[model samples]
Target: MALIGRISLDVVARPQEPTAKKRCLDEPQPDTLKRAKFSDEDYDANKRLRKFQESWKVTYPWVTHEAYDDDQKPGLMFCATCRAYPDLADKSSALYVGCSNMRVDPLKKHEFSSAHIKATNKKTKDTMTMKERSELATNSPIVKATKRCMQITMNILVVMFNTVYSLAKKCKPLSDFETHMELHVKNKKDIGGDYMDIGTNYHNEKRAKEFLMSIGEQLRVTKTRLIEKVRFLTVLADGSTDSSMTEQYTVLVRYVSEGYPVTTLASIEDIENANAFGVKNGIENGLNKIGITDSSKIVSVNFDGAAVMMGCKSGVSALMKEKNPRIVLIHCVAHKLELGVLDAVRSIDYLLKFEDIVKSIYKFYARSTKRRRDLQAFADILESELLHYGDVKTVRWVASKARALRAIQQNLFATLGHLEHAASANKTEESGKAKKLLHEMKSARFVKYLHLMMDYLEIITATSKKFQQNKLLIMEVPDIIKSTTDELTLMIEEPGHQTSTFYDHYDPETGDFTDHGDHVMKLSGQRLTTYEEDNDKTTLLKQTVKYLEVRFMDFNEKPLKCFDAFNLNKWPTNDTELVKHGRDDIKELTQHYIDILTDTEHSSMLREWTIMKNLLRKKKTGINCHDLYCELLQTQPADIQNILTLVNIMVSISPSTAECERQFSAMKLIKSCRR
Candidate 1:
């Protein structure tokens, strides 16, 4: 008190402190009235938002469990109407809003209304304040139950999402979620980053496994979209790195006989060797887990052609011998097919050069995050729609698809234009080389023949599947096989089919365009004006039709009762027909593949293996010796043992990489769905 008096005296002496403002003690004015207003524009916007929400609600049911954006946060059982309208306004007007429970629940709100029955707020016996009311119902059981129901729906959605991507579509958003949600359930489980899924928590391992099993069980309950009944299971194992850099192996098994591609079994395996062993066992277990097993029911095992899985005599291939001794070890044909194309590209001088340029471009574009973005920008600037959206039809020149080669032949000049422009900003030795390569690519003799391959691929891929499924509609495999082989042989043998040079050959005998020699001998040279466009189209059309017919015909000969049925064809007369057809097809495919691979840097050595498999098929009496090599080679061959491995891949394994490839497609959708 003394200190205060001293300060006050000091202030008075200083004269700096103005006379203390006299307090205005008069009472304040009364509060102003509040009014509500509405506009057509606001009404329209609200209607639109409502429509969007409702649409989302139908598409994404999990949203039902989710707290509405405008709803109250956890702790209340809000009526839908009241949840939508959280505040009451215009008491004298008909437009009313507020928690419906507050109006209808006599215990909570004595004046509750559903059909707008008017009610007045009645004082409780204690005349409780707002704080007192909340305190008495803080852990409200009704609110908790509402939240629990929401949690159940969310759990259902999560389980569905893990099994299939097309489950959860979209849900609408609300303006006020908090006012409606009296008891909210937060993310109760850790979601995985890989696939938008309820993630695995080691602390909850047993629960997670059970949940995963339940997901599988749920899929079974989902009307069993599986088209094919269980048959010879064709297993394929391939390893890949996830976003987290963990090396995960995916094992897929196809149940043959189904014409359409369907995943009969799928599983993700571990990385450790024990894990590798575990993965293999897990695959076997999962097959049983998905209803598979018994030795003879399993027909083929296809892998990445890795020695770890394919080595002769001692690997998993042999382990299968104890189960199904005749189970063939097939290599993924797409891998070999691609390898063949790479090999073929490597054989040609300009094509090889062009491929190298493409490699350089791919590397530059794919080197890092910044580079990829720059590549996209460059693509946009160049407006080269053919910068390979990552497909077979437009993979530069070498890695291009069979049908695209023809288009690429004509488009080579245009592609060069893109490469030239792309090179302008790239001031390196690569740029200069690329410019020269641009010219070679356009002039390359084999350009026109690339499309011819489309017919071949169409024939092979379709026919291969039909043959595997025993659903080939064709009669007499030999007749069709012979004709088909002869057709391709004859096509390749055509004089104009393989031109050697870009310009007309100047015949020394006549010094004119008239002395145009056979072009087949000149395939190593270039293109000519005589090359007819209709000729290519006609031949492709013929081949494609014939191929399709044969494939369908093949379906009739031996309905594919098993997956990976390479040699699964019935013997025309003897018990050896399956082996014969398999041997012949492998040789032919390997040749065509090798023909494509003549120049590829990464040689798949399918040709060598094709020969080896044929030799095995021929030696009918040497089961003991052949069986020795089978076990030895199928287990794990040394680095030098690739030749033996390649044969087993082509002769015995999955005809195509469709199982894993389909998985890849599914993975893409899964990622987007999760995101």
Candidate 2:
């Protein structure tokens, strides 16, 4: 359907000349095509300028062939200053001018001009004042727009990286955001949305890695500043294997920053082995690379109680101490506690049997798909959810043992039903294993010991968690160890704690007092023995308490005992009693450094110790010792400088190397099997 009729009005021009004769297919190229695609106006402009030889540099050394514009048919020469700052051009100055003349030696003439001399002496735009640059930048639309675009692109990259890091997500956001913007540009141009295509590099894996490295460099710079500001810090080191099975040691620096504990991950180094020599070298090289020039600044070294790390003579800590006598070595308190728990558990026979039974029940379901399915079916029939069994983490974190026990306890009824059903079925390998698991799960001894170990390890795991806290103070650690030991002692001696934990009935509705009567009744063949014969629970608790006391007794030895004096509890409130304190622990603590300190400084420290006691009594509110020292620093009291110096010594003492252990946890996430 035609909407309107077309109008036909045409006029023809008179033909004055005919087209040129057609050339043959194999004819030589036309003269017009043989010449470069220069327009007549450009040709005329170039013809007007005097051409100069390329050797003009001989007479004018500053003139270079790089100034030539190769895009022009005959090319043109430009002064370097004029090219760099094209707006500097003027009618009188040959220096601020460009020329295409074949006959005139403009370069030679321009070199001697006063304008050229002035332009050469002027600073480049990079050195220009901010105000001048801002004015110039804002006036030029192209430059301003380009800069705005570049700034926006950088902002986008920063936000993208921040989101990825903050959320602990992968690099997908980097590419995903770019892809979304690309799609929007394609489909929403009419709506005024803008996304200039920077293409694959902006969103690719290579660019993502480059940006990550750039962030690492920035963090390193910040870490360096913090380290230098603190001047002296303890080195907390630990080694762990990645998913790829490569042993990497992470070095962390612990120092007091603004009244709080500040721990920075200084470096992550891959070592040849986990031996003392290899780890020690890795640490030295890593710290050196990170700008820690003086080993003497390492006032203390802390690591786990591994033989290679804490060996008295040949360990990494010993090696460091040998190099610098001032560096005191301390083992990780949390790790030592975990080791004690492991030792206590392993020493008992019935407790080991309990652990084996729990592990066996987990494997019974975990190892067989059919068994897990059957358990799930039983859980569904009973209107409950099945719990997954946890693997025991042998890395001194006893929390996993609790999780495993809890899972079994939660699903005890359904799991037993599933096993009972399997046991009653026709004979099969699965049935046989199910019958055995059912027998153990129903044993009165197994039920009692499971509850026993679960409760005992809960205390150990809690202490572990407390030690791993980022803000825990070194002075606070001795108290924490004592309290933990006291809690274990209470757990051993107090019958109420025992009866409530191990023997009490767990109520599912109230989420307390779970009873094991029904699980014990389903025992295939085993029965409960007399109470006198079954003293496993009492024995396990006693062993745990004994081991803890032996392990934690390290706090009482030598220079470490001096740290206990620094605790505010020991600081005498009366000035008359300051010099007559309980023991001369400070002398022993600082005895090794007497040669390093001047007589005046030593006297100042003795005087400050007296004043520090008064300061503590004056500010009577409860505050952490490390925090109190930092607060005192703000007043800049001359009398407290020496006392503050002593506080720094205490602050430098690492309570534990748990942060390094946490880094390994992050390593597992970062370097996953798929990753």
Candidate 3:
């Protein structure tokens, strides 16, 4: 006989031969010895087993639980204690069965069975002790809540840290952070819960300073990681006098990190001496502080062409060159370009006089309180906002000139009105000065010169800005210089540009160019007519073109030929000098990077060069070295590694020390007069 527990009627039984012997009641069940198959009846019975414990656990506390709905069958509920032993299933009463109706009180009857007591004693003897269970329950909730609280605190700290670092980078005062925290605290109270204490912990300057230091450490660690991978580096430094009368040198490091050129500020330190040795020692100290010790790893050094910095025997570039003969020395391209522009304009007499006239106009108003007030009165009368007249600064070559011209252009009518009124009044010493300015402003030559120079300055200013970009590449600058010079040439040679759109104050409603005729006609009783150009305009254009040719000739020199070799628009032909420079001169500098390629890659390099010549001829403009390298890498992968490596190495030589100039700007904000 077999116990048929939760057996479905639909189950098919295997045929068995009839036996003569009668089975005894004490025989073990065949199904229980082997695993049972799943049936619909078992699934129905499993549901009943779960509901039984929920309603009857309190009525029979000694009856322990078991899981049902297992893989072999729908499953069964059994007494926990009785199921612990193996032989009880063969008894007249087995204590385990599938749960059905809770109303039958099956668990109550099973609790009193004799087999239950033995199994319960065996299982409890080996289970967890009462003290151990109690300790686990007590500590689990506390550990979870502590972790949640710490996570919230760390999140708040991170937010405060980012806030302080952002404000510090912009040179904002730390008191602003306190005010921000106060606002947050008030908002938190209004929201009705004390969920976090972020405002309380970081609402002061001391904490803000600590956060700023932590951010600095994070940047240092990141730079260190990048430096560890660099095969070579270039160190750039320049000296400037800050507002505090202290000599400061800003140090920058240029290196290849992950196949791209990156220039990052290493440090800014104050020095007593402002010579080559002072800057050299200061840079060495900064490099040491940043953990860069190997001088041999420095492949190049760049600085402005100042005598103190670019001197052949004693300059920083020359001194570094002495230590490592393989190292390249480059004067800052932006500084050289600015000097070229200055040299170009200085050769012409009228252009020099034009610059003086612009400076005089700025000073006439800025140096006199009465003239400034009179100019403001005229501006107000015309319903225009106050104008900022800028002074000429020696260091800010392009921007200062451009700004002064733009100011005069934007407020031409009001300026002319103020000068004419002052000339008519003639009540003070400034009136006499204003009378002279009135005559100059009304001159036909001055008007034409203003238009000509303003247009020229606009081009120079735009190119100068590109030069000052923080990560300018050396190969990219020659194109900008060529384009500027070409544009300047076009302005000189191209016809009818004089009658083209000139910078003038425009009427918002009418969309026509407005002039000082109405204001001057009323004050001087004479109507101002349009100015006609004289021969000075032709002379000005000629001198500008001549100066550009003389100054930009250096970029075409043999030593700098490598910088121009890859230009798509100006590809060198098979001239002996060009081929020699492209092969021998460039190879001398790029040999270190070329050594990194495998034999197969070196073969690929020659193939890529031949392909580039054809491709570049088709696409003359806007194809940079990086673009050419990418095309080569796609078409021929096996040959591109050496060229790619060389391009990355060459680009790491920064074209300007503008980053050093920026540090001085920051120093002014940090050590302002109030500080």
Candidate 4:
């Protein structure tokens, strides 16, 4: 709209001046047709100052100075506080203020609406409010009279406008229907509904996000009704990169509990640029929403125990320190347990050996889809009637080596049968390889000792009805140590006790003894009479005594307290295996311990089978307790699963999401739709 002041010049008749000659007006230049350009500093500034002063006079009459020079532009700019050097020559642009939108805090932007009452309470039968006076155009006489009055007023205003500046504004507010129109306009478009046609739609997409945030707030408030409200919560944040994708993570309390399952999630905040102080921003924003923040209420900020997360700069822990150094960074226990188990399982001999065998065996059996199916079928058949998932069926875990040991034993017979069939079908070298595996596998003690390696609970199924049930042993510190020590001494002493008996002489070439070397010989000479006699007696006696005293001690005592019972019952009364012919087979090798577990040790372990049965209480209850142990009554160890089971026992009994899994799940769903 352009403004022009009217100028009137009246002619004073001077001797009846002759009429002026009419000259043709040349057509305007094409360049002159161009609309007015605003390239001048002084003119634009003067106009803006005048307009600003006029607005001030109407809206802020308290200001003293109203007059303004357009060339000087008496405008206080939104960006006048910007850090820049101001120059007088730069009046074409800003001296200090620059082109930028003013900051508007959401709560400060608009006035609330007791001022904007609807004419007829739309949903209720209340009287009309002033703002709604224009909308109450019902068929009732009062409403009709009001509508006619409004129309007459509007017509009177149009006539008045002809006397003033000739209707410079293009847009006009509707005379009636103000309240209903306000509601309709809001329903059709975005927010800021007061000025109907100002087009606030695309400019305020952040409002959509703000609306979603309100929903999240409602969810958190509902979920946290059961928890102790933290006055201020310190957000724990991290950035996770998955397959080169990055997301910002913020953790806040959503659930309420005094002790156990305490919190749930409100939302996931993906970091856009990861502002240098996202942690600070997150903490501040979160605390503000919770509506009770003091710097003191932020007592803790726990983070993943990574170096970066606790480092001195932008770490979640460190960031909180930047604000309040008193905020603590606690370590997550599950992570610590993983580190522990990783350490303990290293350098374990059996596991290393087992891993080697399993990697090979699993690879071979898992070669094709058919073979994998066959394995599952074999596991199922071994499980009879129908397989329950719990039936010692193989599943891979971190210590997969241990499971592999059981696997070799459980399916040995079935494996051998399959290989034999394979040999019959194809007698090639590959088949020969299978035959070799069968042969080598058949030699291992796993098949013979399979029952010993299984969980005691499984053994209860195969147990004889005649035998007594085992008892679980709850071990106290003293008892555990006592059992361990006694078992070791017993194993060590037994061998010597057996060798205490006298044997005379044995033939050199054949083991058969001459009559002089038969049984029941005495300590014939305290001192040897001759060198030959001295040599023989000293050689034999010293060797036998040394073997019992030193070597046996080491072998007997090395196993853990859990295996103590085996040492007690499996000990040797005599170093001999009885043959079918009822003769003793004597061998120097019995003391050599070719098998990792000695026979006497195995026997002793079997004798105290009740103790072995107690070790696996963590897996099943009352299943392995034999009748004898039941008669005796012993407490058993807790059935634990993985290392995390302890953490599960201690911290997770409360049952809230320990992480933002649920909130993240919803957020992920949204992103999936976007893709």
Candidate 5:
């Protein structure tokens, strides 16, 4: 019975299967195979699997589920922005394709990932209009943060630069840069950011030196540009040994800038050899460094009266003149004055003796603190203020000697009292020297010579001060020399006030002393006879006058004398006198500067010279050459351009090397022994 039932069931199932199998084979086989592979139990189990949640979209806006047609299937998660811009997406990231492992961790990780953020930003940028993109970029938090960082960095750099500049300008050592930066950081805590805390390596001595060099290079470039624009310039040079015993030559350029003569230091070179050729090379190198390559642009050169600098044939000035014959070579007038005075002093025996005594007195007090205290004590006792003794410098002889003489004169009674006390106190070597100095001080001849020199130097010292003036013009030099010579000549006829006062102290006839004033000592030596005194005075005064004339004889000659025409103070007031007044001078000046002027310019200068005289005569105002030239420069008339240029050259010519001397003084301060 079971076999018969099985066969009957197989027969019934086979007929139903045939129709179903036929249908499956006729239709697509993929869906039928899928249905055959999974039963209802398996489908229910797979539908229970975890899927991308819609709630994740709240936390991660870039998250989205994979598209599905049926609700029974599990969905994959993905970053929609990353999928749209696949290049900006991470290739290994599961979210970049479709994340089947639909956990919140992967979605959260992808949302904050660099790739996802970049894709999101790119999508936002692509969708915006131009104006909208600009606004978004401007208002973005990241951009604002970046700008703030840049601003802080710039502020830090500015502070560092300013600190370096301040130290350099004050001539402080570069090693002090660390200390200065620390001070800034302490005062302004936010100045250097992390740089300040990490040590001074960022702003150390090496960095300071680099900053200083950069600053110097920039300033040099700027000055070179300014010099290249000017038509003419004057050069002043001087050489000296620094603390390291290195010979340094300082070169300065003088040019007319905005109607004022500006003397600027161009360069300070370390010269191995300080001879004529070496010094000339140094000067040319300095000028070249400042963009002054054309030797013809140099209108004048002023140097001290050293043979190597001012020699006629083989000197620096001569060499420069050989290159450009139009250049005017000037011996520093201040140096000339000093030399002239020294020559006169060397001719007189008593004056030389007087100089030795003065120097000895200075050294005696300067060397001993005890002697200085005693001198000060005696000075206080006499109720007179005394100046400290100054060394008699051989370079600036007259001025330094005058200061020393003034000190002695003010402390005359105090010095005598100190000497008398020391002489009586003991038999020490110092006391013996004091006794000898006291004997010399008490002599009538010594007192007379002291006051005589004091009076004579007072005049020369005043003249020396004028000669050292930086703005002293060549046209005014002759007048200064003439006035100084006349004042000295007047001193010869009428004795100086101090000398005449000394004569009042003692009896003229007898060789005996009278009741001396409290300021001076009673003298016991023989007084000078009137003839001897006159002869001595005549010798010093006449020799000084003669030497001054000889030393400054060039100022009275050709081109320099012709510059007098530019002296408005000496201009003739009358029209008849003015018409022909500067005609010869103009011709000579034009001929002198023929190389510097064109033929048209020469003719224009001649015509303008007369016109200028006439125009200035109409105004009749007492204006100086500099002031007149500056006013004319404001208008810059076409006809007077050549004359104006001539005046510019003249004013730019320095009368002395005082500017170079000042630079040396500054160099000494900067490169001191301790440094």
Candidate 6:
């Protein structure tokens, strides 16, 4: 009974000569069966599965068939390029492997996909050699456009750099960048095309400041690199109060570059303290900023003769020497001369009073425009040009004092005429003051003091100017001091040119004024005895000469005196004298800078020195040390490197801190109250 029931169920499920609708309802269709078979993992050998079509290659060139060993095995479709380089193929795409979905839709979708397009390009690029690819890239329009854009950007940056550098050099405000850019765009259209629009972002003050900072940093880096290459340098520093009432320290470095001494500003920084420690720290910080960490490289330091700067036991100079025992301490020669002259003048009561009167006269005229115009009127009537009255101060420049004295002397008659008119015509307090000044100007004693001071300052002023030279060598300082002292010594017996003119107006024996034709100065005061006048003149001359001798006595001593060996003009004429000349001094110099020279170099220097002297004696050279060094460099010998280095060190020692003073002047101009 069970077999009969099973046979009946099987007969119901089976069908004879199946119709299309019955087959669709009861069994899978041929196409559906083929798709199902293709989806199977082991369907590659199935004949019922869909096969790759050759016609699809016409629609998709990348389409190709996967091969099988058996002819009856089903074929599969894939992207030939993606299959070749599988790394470039999209893993999510059926085309990465072999696709059995034989319809054209999947091939078309992959052909338009980003991955397939990327893969196609990579494959095409790979087929060519490196040189072929390079040529193709070089000729590509896209590459050309990219290069052009980069060039335009660089040109715009160059223009902006130049503009910022110009404005900074002129000390103009950076806010003017936009105005400058506009000017450039209008005048220099060809510099950068369409760069104006791009440069708008950089036209503001913020960007201009950044540009300036970048340029400054680049320049500083270049200067630091140059400083690092030098073996020896001199440090010049000074302290001052700026517009903001901040204690500012200005530092300058002097070194030899290309066989010439160059003095450049290292820094101008605000300091919380101005004592020795503070100043020393500031100098170290400035040197460190320029990459000079080795203090031993410092051959010398120049500063004013302030107690804190020049004190032997504890001062900036002493502190610097603690770091390198060989470092020489230089008291600024200009300041020394100035202090010496002023001290000598102040020692006498009459000259001290004369300075005060000169200052008062300058203030009286300088403060009043009305008085100045009156003075000018008097000057015009006298057929003389009115010179501006300059103030005299203790710490002021000798040149300024000279100018003030010159102005007063040239306009003395005119000033007296104005005062005479103001005192008599006007009845006011100013008139009263004017009368008092008139009385003082008409005194023979005041006139004599004025002429004497003018003569004295003239000699000192010339020496001060010489000391302020940028490349002034230590060897030249002694001669300057001697010449100045000699002139003052001569003035003790004979009066100066200006003073001699005054002597013409007076009787020497009686010390009384003589009436001279057309002389504007009619002296009216208690006449001095010949002994008193002669005593005043002699006292002033003798004191000035003595002060100079005592103050500049260091120039005749050790390390400084050794530099005189380099002064070719001082070399002895005879060979016997020449061979032995400066030998002790040269040894002293090498011993002074012993740390800077190696033992090998120290011994070689003497030999090189002898050779150099002989060579220079044979050659036509300038008498100055710098000129001689230049000649030595031109005919450089194999063993003279040490000698050349010593010469550079000698020349690098500046005679004064004038470079620092000049930098301060520039700083005042650049950072004024209005700025």
Q: Write the per-residue lDDT of candidate 5 for residues 1-675, one digit (tens) a residue.
A: 999999999888874424443465567566545754678988877675676678888888877788567765567777788889988889789987687786788877777889888998899889999999889887899998998888877777677778888876777777888988777667556665554333344668888778778888999999999988998889999999899999999999998888778899999988757789899999888888999988888889999999999999999999999999988999999899999999998888987877777777887788788988999999898888878875445313677777777778768788889999999876699888898889887777777788888898899999888878777778988888889899888887788877777777656565444324455346757657652356888889889999999999998888888888888878888879988887787788889888888888888887888887777765547565556766776677776777876778778888988888888888887788866
Per-residue lDDT tens digits for candidate 3, residues 1-675, read 133532432244545679898778898768757776899988877763324445455665544444456633323345555655646431444336544343435666666666766666566655859886676655788877987888998878877887898788898877677887777677778875755556586589888878877898888888877787776788888887777778888888988665456688888887657777777889888887677888866767878878988898898888877877766677777787678777767766767777777778887776678778878889989877666785445314465676777677667778888887877784887678878887776554565556666777787888888888855666677688778877776766442333233324322233244454444322221332332333544555566666656655655664455656555555555544333334443454354444444565455544455544555555556656655544553454443455554555566677788877887788678666654
Q: Evaluate model 5: give its lDDT.
A: 0.81
lDDT of 6 by residue, 601-630 (tens): 788888888887887786535366666675
Ranking by TM-score: 6, 5, 2, 3, 1, 4
- TM-score, cand. 3 vs. native: 0.68
Q: What is the TM-score of each candidate against the true structure?
A: 0.41, 0.72, 0.68, 0.32, 0.76, 0.78
Q: Count the backbone clashes (under 3 Å) in each candidate.
A: 78, 16, 1, 30, 0, 0
Better by lDDT, candidate 3 or 2: 2
Q: Tell me the alpha-carbon RMSD of every candidate.
A: 28.6, 17.2, 16.8, 32.2, 13.5, 14.6
Candidate 1 Cα errors over 4 Å, as ranges: 1-214, 220-234, 255-263, 274-279, 291-300, 326-328, 332-351, 357-400, 403-407, 416-434, 442-484, 495-655, 668-675
Q: Which ranges of candidate 5 are over 4 A from the true structure?
A: 1-171, 174-179, 189-204, 391-396, 505-520, 529-533, 618-624, 634-639
Point to the candidate with the largest TM-score: 6
Q: What TM-score would you give candidate 1 relative to the actual structure?
A: 0.41
Better of 1 and 5 by TM-score: 5
> Candidate 4 — worst ten consecutive residues by lDDT sum?
578-587
Model 6 score (lDDT): 0.81
Off by over 4 Å in 4: 1-229, 232-244, 247-250, 254-261, 272-295, 310-315, 349-368, 376-675
lDDT of predicted model 4: 0.35
Order candidates by lDDT, high to low: 5, 6, 2, 3, 1, 4
Off by over 4 Å in 3: 1-146, 193-195, 366-387, 391-396, 424-427, 470-472, 494-554, 571-638
Tens digit of per-residue lDDT, candidate 4, span 1-675? 122222222233335668996645674546766687565786765653222334533442222232335545443432121122122113333312332222222112211212111211222334457556545447569878988888866654333332121211211221222332344456547655443242223122243334344545665676554333532333434445332365546455521123222344433454555554664565456544545345554444545446656566766567666766544344332233223323332434443443344455555565555544554565454452211122233533223323554565445544555555555656586476666555544432222122222321122112211111111121111232234334333433232211121112322233332222222112111222322332322332233233323322322231112222222232233424211111111121111222322455434432233333334223234443222222222222233112111111112111112254334444444444322
TM-score computed on alpha carbons, candidate 5: 0.76
